[model samples]
Every structure is written in C-alpha cells, then in structure tokens.
Target: MTLAKAAAEVRERAWVPYSRFKVGAAIRAASGKVYAGCNVENVAYPEGTCAEAGAIAAMCAGGDYKIAEVYVIADSPEPVPCCGGCRQKIAEFAGPDVRVTMATTDGKEKTVTVAELLPGVFSAAHMDRA
Candidate 1:
C-alpha cells in the first residue's frame, strides 16, 4: 500500500480523547520496510506520543536507522504539518533530502524535504564546533 494509505489506515486506531484529533504516520526505512503508527494520547496530555515518534520508534525496533521517506495524515481543513519535535525526530533519522509528505484525510497534501522542514538542524557536527 502507498505510504499515504498506510497512514490513513492507522489513523483509525489513534487514541486521542481530549483533542479528538487523530493523526497517523508512516515511514519507509532505507531498508525498504514501511512502518506505521497512530497518535497515542495519554490523559496527562504532555505524555502523549505523536504518530511520527511512534513510527520512528517502530523503525528503530525493526533495526533500521535511516528513514528514506515519510507520510503523515490527519483529518483537518488543510494538510497538517509535523510538530516541531517530530520534525526534529525525522531529521535525526533521515537525511536532509528525505521527503516528508503531509496530508489531510480528504486528499489535500504537501511534500517537502526534511531540510526544508527544519533548515540547519542541529547535528552531531555542531558538537565538534570549536
């Protein structure tokens, strides 16, 4: 299945109660495996897990460290972009050229690279700066 379709399918399982906003994410690892996850919210709010984070976790669990592409789907008036933390998470597992696709349930969508979403992202190289 397409990444967008995978995300949309997983969205049905999101555990959002407070906001009632469900989100889903799918990531294609460099190994060509597709992992999917749905937002899992907790009553404590701050402890909630974003779909992107969950997907990344699954990828790591499956022994893949590089993300080649990602797709996220949400029910909204417009394509919903990843949260700031998720953008950084994506950057951590993906290269600057990795494509990130944001989409609404009704098919509206936008695609951009990880670099475009988080320009000049913090990397290990920054720690080497003198």
Candidate 2:
C-alpha cells in the first residue's frame, strides 16, 4: 500500500480512548518496505506513544535501520506536524534531506525535509571526541 493509504488505514486503529485524538504514521524503510503504526494512548496521559515512534520501532524490528521517507496523518483542520520527540527520532533514522509528509484527513498536506523539520538537530556527530 502507498504510504498515505497505509497511514490512513492504520489511523482507524489508534487506541486513544483518553484524548479521542488519533494519529497514524507510515515509514518507507531503506529496505523498500512500508511500515505503518497508530497512536497508542495510556491512562497516564503523556505516556502515550506517538504514531511516528511506533512506525519507527516497526521498521527497526523489520530489520531496516534507515528511513527513506515518512508520512503522518491526523484528523485535524490542517496537516499536523510531528511532535518534537518524533522529529528527533526521525532525524536519527533518516537523512537530513529525507522528506516527511504530514496530512489531514480532509486532504490538506504539507511536506518538509528532515533538515527543515528540525534545524540544528542533535545527532551522534555531537558525541565525537575529535
């Protein structure tokens, strides 16, 4: 399935009883496989898992460490951007030039590269002793 279709399809399965807000994410791994995930909420509020993180986990479990592209969908008036944490997680697996597409259920969409999404992102490069 296409990234958008996979995200939209999985969105219906979000476990968001607390907030009633749902989100879905799909990632195209460097292996050329598509992995989809839906938000999973917890009673502890912020303990809930974002869809992007779930999708990234699935990609890793599927043995793909690199992300080629990403798509996230939500039921909002406008395309919803990834949460701060998800942006960093995505940057860890995707190149600075990788495209991330955000979309609303109503058809509105926004696309930005990883660098644009998280300018001055912190990476392993910062850990180098040299």
Candidate 3:
C-alpha cells in the first residue's frame, strides 16, 4: 500500500482506548519495503509506544534499519506530525532529506523532510565509536 493508505489503515486499527487518541505510521525502508504500525497505548502511558516506534520495531525485527519515507496519521484538525522522540528515531535511519508526510483527521496533509521536522537533530554521528 502507499504511504497514505498504509498510515490510514494503521490509524483505523490503533489501540488507544485510554487516550482515545489513535495514531498510525508507515515507513518505507531502504529495501523499498513498506512497513505500517498503529499506536498501542497502555493504561500506563509510559508503557505505550507510538505508531512510528512500532513501525521501526517491526522493521528492525525484520532486519531493516534504513528508512526512506514516512507517513503519519492522526485525527486532529491541526497537523499531527511525528513527536520529537519519533523524529529522533527516524533520523537514525531516514536521511536528512527523507520525506515525512503528516495528515490530520480533517484530510489536510503536511509534507516535509527530517531536517524540516527536526532541525539540529541529534544522532549517533555525534557519539564516539568504541
């Protein structure tokens, strides 16, 4: 499925009973494989993971670490882009110019790159390799 369709499908199946705020995310890996995920919220919010996180986990579990594109969906009037944490995660795999598509419940979509979404983002490149 396309990024938009995958994210939409994931959103339709998000598990956010507590927050009643569902979210969906889809990412295209360097392998040209598309992965989709839905928010799985727990009663203990801290235990919950974002849709992007889930997608990354799924891809990693399948031996994919490179991301090419990403799409997010949320039922809100305003643009529901990926969170700061999610942005960092995406940066680990997605390129600085990787495309990120965010869509709101109102059908409005915002497209940008990782740099546009998270300027001056931190990454492993800053760390010392032992």
Candidate 4:
C-alpha cells in the first residue's frame, strides 16, 4: 500500500483514551519495505512515544538503517511534526535527506527532509570517546 494509506490505516488503530489524540506513522526503508505504526499511549504520559518512533524501532529491529520515506498522520488541522525525541530517533536511521511528510485528517499535508526538520541536529557522531 501507499505511505499515505498505510499511515491512515495505522491512525485508525491509535490507542488514545486520555487525550483522544491519535496519530500514525508509516516508514519506508531502502529495502522497499514499509512498516506502519500507531501511537500507543500510557497513563504515565511521558512514557509514551510517538508513532514515528515506534515505526523506527520496528524497522531497526529488522536491521534496516535507511529510511527512504516517512509519513505521519494526525487528527489535528495543522501538521504535527515529530517530537524532538522522535526526530533524534529518526536521524539514527534515516539520512539527512530522508523524506518526511506530515498530514492532518482534514487533508492538509506538508513534506520536508529530515535535515530540514531538524537543522544542526546533534547525533551520536558528535559524542566523544570516554
């Protein structure tokens, strides 16, 4: 299926009871495989991660380190960009030019590159040896 379709499909499964805010993400890897994930929330709040992060984690588990494209869908009118943590997680697998798309339930959409989303991003490469 297409990235948009996958994202929407995942969005339908989001488990958000507290805020009733649902979001979904679809990640395409260099291998031409796509993984879909929906946000899973916990009552603990901060413990919950975005659907993008979950998708990236699943992709990493399968040894795919190159995200070709990433799409996110949310229920809001404005496009919801990945959080700081998710952006860092995305950088761990995708390249600087990795495609990132954001969409709202109202059909509004926007596309950006990973580097564009997180300019001057800090990565593990910046870490020094102990």
Candidate 5:
C-alpha cells in the first residue's frame, strides 16, 4: 500500500488521550517493505512516543535500517512537520536526499528532503577518528 494510506490507516489507532492529537507515520525501507506507526501519548506529558520514531522502531525491528521514503499524516491546518528529535532520528537512517512527505488529514501536503529537515545533521562520520 502507499505510504500515505498506510500512515492514514495507522493513525486511527493512536493512543492519544491527553491532547487528542493523533499522528501517523509510514516508512518505505530500502528493502521495499513498508512499516507504519502511530503516535502514543501518555499522562507523563513528554514521555509519549512520536509517530515517526515508532515507524523507525518498527522498521528496525523488521530488520531494515535504511529508510528510502517517509510519510506522516495528522489532523491540522497544514502539513505537520516532524519534531526536532524525530528529524534527527530519520537523518540517522535515511540519506540526505531521502524524501519526507508531511500531510494533513484534509489532503494538504508538503515535501522536503532529509537534508532540508535537519541541515548539518550529526552523523557517525562526525565521530570518526580518521
């Protein structure tokens, strides 16, 4: 299924009780497999899981570490962007040019690359001893 559809479907299962703001994410792994996730909120405020992070976790659990494309959907006035931490997490598994599509439930969408999402992203190369 398409990333958009996958994300939209999973969004319905979000465990959001505090803000009632549900979000969903889907990733197309380099293995050509699609993984989907939904945001899970908790009463602890910041302890909740983000949709993008959950999708990445699912991808890793499925044995695919590389992300080719990503889609995120939410109910909002405009396409919702990933949080700063999710952007960094995505940059870790996706190349600079990987496409990230953010969309609103009403059909509005905005596309950007991994590089655009997190410029000067910190990577393993930065820790190389060479």
Candidate 6:
C-alpha cells in the first residue's frame, strides 16, 4: 500500500475528541520499513502528540534513524503540511532531498523535499561546527 493510504488508514485510529481534526503520518525508514502513526490529542491542550512525531518515535523504536520518505494526510480542503516541529523532526531523520508528501483525505496531494519544508535547518552538522 502507498504511504498516503497508510496514513489515511491510521488516521481513523486517532484520538481527537477536542478539535475533531484527525491527522495521520507515515514514514519510510532507510531500512525499508514503513512506520505509521495518528494524532493523539489530550484534553489539556498543547500536550497532544502529533502524528509525525509518533511515527518518528516508532521508527526510532524500530532501530531506524534515517527516513527515506514521508507522507502526511488530513481531512481538509487542501493538503496539510507538517507543522513547524514536524518539519524540523523530518529534517532530523531525513536528508535535504528526502521527499515529503502532504495529502488531503479527499485526494489532493503535494510533494516537497525536506529542505523545501525547512530551509537552513539546524542539524547536528551545525552543532558539530560549534
């Protein structure tokens, strides 16, 4: 199954009682394994887990530190790109050229690279230079 489809499928499992906005994410690890996650919102607000973050955590738990590609899906009029935190997280696990696919539940889709999502990302390389 495609990454977008995987994201959409997992979206059904999201725990979003407040905003009722469900989001899903899928990441392809360098090890060729696909990890998927859904947003889990909490009542406290601002303490919810993003779908992309959850997916990355799963990838890490699976022992994969590199992301080959990513897909995010949400039920909106346009494709929903990752938030700022997720954009940075993507840059952490993927190279600048890694493809990030953003999609709407109704089939609208857009593709951008990690660098496009977050230009001049603060990565470990920059830290190493310090």
Q: How would you encode candidate 4's per-residue C-alpha lDDT over 1-130 as one tens digit per residue? A: 9999999998999989888899999999999999888899999977776899888887888788789999999989799999988888888888999989999988999999999998988988789787
User: Local distance difference test, per candidate?
Assistant: 0.94, 0.97, 0.90, 0.90, 0.98, 0.93
Q: Model 2, 1-130: lDDT tens per residue?
A: 8999999999999999988999999999988999999999999878989999999999999999999999999999999999999999999999999999999999999999999999999999999996
Model 1 off-target regions past 4 Å?
none
> What's the true lDDT of residue 36 in model 2?
92
Q: Which is superior by lDDT, 3 or 5? A: 5
For 54-89, candidate 6 gives per-residue lDDT tens digits of 999999999999999999999999998899999998
Give the lowest summed-lDDT range of ten residues in model 1: 120-129
Worst 10 residues of 4 by lDDT: 45-54
Query: Which residue runs does candidate 2 get wrong by more than 4 Å?
Result: none
Tell me the TM-score of model 1. Answer: 0.97
Q: Which residue pairs in candidate 1 have backbone atoms (N, alpha carbon, C) closer than 3 angstroms, thus clashing?
A: none
| Better-scoring candidate (TM-score), 3 or 5 | 5
Best candidate, lDDT: 5
Query: CA shift at 43, candidate 4, in angstroms?
Result: 0.8
Comparing candidate 5 with candidate 6, which one achieves the higher lDDT? Answer: 5
Off by over 4 Å in 4: 128-130
lDDT per residue (tens digit) for residues 1-130 in model 5: 9999999999999999899999999999999999999999989889999999999999999999999999999999999999999999999999999999999999999999999999999999999996
Question: What tens digits encode model 3's per-residue C-alpha lDDT throughout 40-105?
Answer: 988875899999999999889888999999999899988787888999999988889999999986
Q: What is the alpha-carbon lDDT of model 1 when measured against the actual structure?
A: 0.94
Estimate, for each residue in 1-130, the C-alpha lDDT of model 1 and write its tens digit.
7898889999999999889999999999999999999999999869999999999999999999999999999999998989999999999999999999999999899999999999989888888958
Residue-pair clash count for candidate 4: 0
The order by descending lDDT is 5, 2, 1, 6, 4, 3
Task: TM-score each candidate.
Answer: 0.97, 0.98, 0.93, 0.93, 0.98, 0.96
